[model samples]
Target: MKIVVAGGTGFLGRHISRALLDAGHDVTVLGRSPDKVSAIPQLRGATATKGDVTDPGTLSGRLEGAEAVVQAVQFPNHPIELPRKNLTYDRYDRQGTINLLSEAERSGVGRFVYISGAGADAASEKTWYRAKGLAERALIGSGIDHAIVRPSWAYGPEDRALNRFVQIARFSPVLPQPGAAPQRIQPVYVGDVARSVARVFERAAWNDVYEVGSREVMTMNEVVHTLLDVMGKKRAVLPIPSGLLKMATAPLKALPTPPMTPQGIEFATQDGLVDITKMVQVLGVEPLSLREGLTRYIER
Candidate 1:
């Protein structure tokens, strides 16, 4: 099988590309910068192509012979450094996804797997969720066979979220959290996410949305403490109110790639745990526990 993975150089995309290659499928990564695409240790046999999904014309001949298309591209965390107008989520998460779906349809691609985040609501007032929700609706309505995999909180080597906690815990005596610090999340390992996506392609899980997560449902405070313990650090947990977190993240609106957006902060304060029974039973995937997942990434 020939597979084309958009955003194949990203955190989870790298794992997915490698898993596909290891499964004996021909893999091609589609990214904007060809020079940025290198032969990853996990994807030694795969190829890379230079193309932007935001512009449908660039992807004309690139996806010609692919049997499956995995849309994994997303906008960077925030619009702080970039102009707010150009950095809007609609451009990439929504319009870019639509453009890719159109091109995939044009090329007669069969299986379409989308890596959408959990808690995306089309009717939500939040811009990011709305964008993802709109794109999801379009994909399902496009008449193409699609599988939407929504992971709770993805963490591993190169992970953006949990790794931050590990890094901060390494030197800090106390970890500051927001909103009661009880907001639960089931952080799934990147390799497990990759395995589940590959399994979906292998079994042709079409016209369904599968939610994936780790084996443990932990509070935000618990996650931080666990990472601290894993790294042999002694750190106390402090829970701040949600209002303060929003105010703290307000200044980051000017950053090009902010570690925390006001929207993301709000989302983080909410419960992000999901039911992964389908992925576990149908896909036959068992994700790592939080402690196990973080230990492999942050061996401190």
Candidate 2:
């Protein structure tokens, strides 16, 4: 099989590309910065092509020989959109997918896979979920044999999400969770996500979508404590009142590359629990529990 993984240089995309390559497929990593594969030893055997899905013009010839196309791209500074640079979820997640589907049609690609997030709803008021939901719809309507895999709070050593807390626990005795909300999340290991995406190509029939996540459901505080316990750290989990945290980070949005934004706060507080039964049944992937995943994450 010949496949193109868009955003192959990214955190999840890199792993997906490697998994496809390991599956004995000819993998090409297409991204805005495809040359990043030079630094990624795991992507050694895969081809790297520079392309941006946000612009249809850039993707015309990119998927020419690809039998399968995977849209795994996300905007820079994710969760903290740089609207000034047109780096919002609507741009990269929604329109970008529409562009890729157009090219896939032209290129006569057989399959399309979208890496969507949990809680995706086209009718939602939230831009992130709405964008992904809209993208899922576009692929379904494209007449392409498509599969959508929605992962819940994917985390790894290189991931930007969980590592933030791990880094904080590295120095401090107390880990301050950004919000007091009992935000439910099922953190999936990145490796499991990559393998599940690769297994989509292995199946005899394609399911419309697979929502992948750990079987273990946990809250924000519980997640942090789990990581601390895995790291042999006795850090206290401190939850900040949402109102105060929002007030504090609201002003920082004015700064370029603001460390935290109101949207980021909302992103941190949102619930991402999903049923993993479909993923297990279809993809044959039972995502690792948060503690099991953290053990692997920290050991490496």
Steric overlap count per candidate: 4, 0
Candidate 2 lDDT over 245-276, as tens digits, reads 88899999889888888888888789998888
Q: Which candidate is the best by lDDT?
A: 2
- Model 1 segments more than 4 A misplaced: 78-85, 252-261
Per-candidate TM vs. native? Answer: 0.92, 0.97
lDDT for model 2, please. Answer: 0.88
What tens digits encode model 1's per-residue C-alpha lDDT throughout 234-274? 88878888888889888876775677766667776777778
How does each model score on lDDT? 0.82, 0.88
Global local distance difference test of model 1:
0.82
Q: Largest TM-score belongs to which candidate?
A: 2
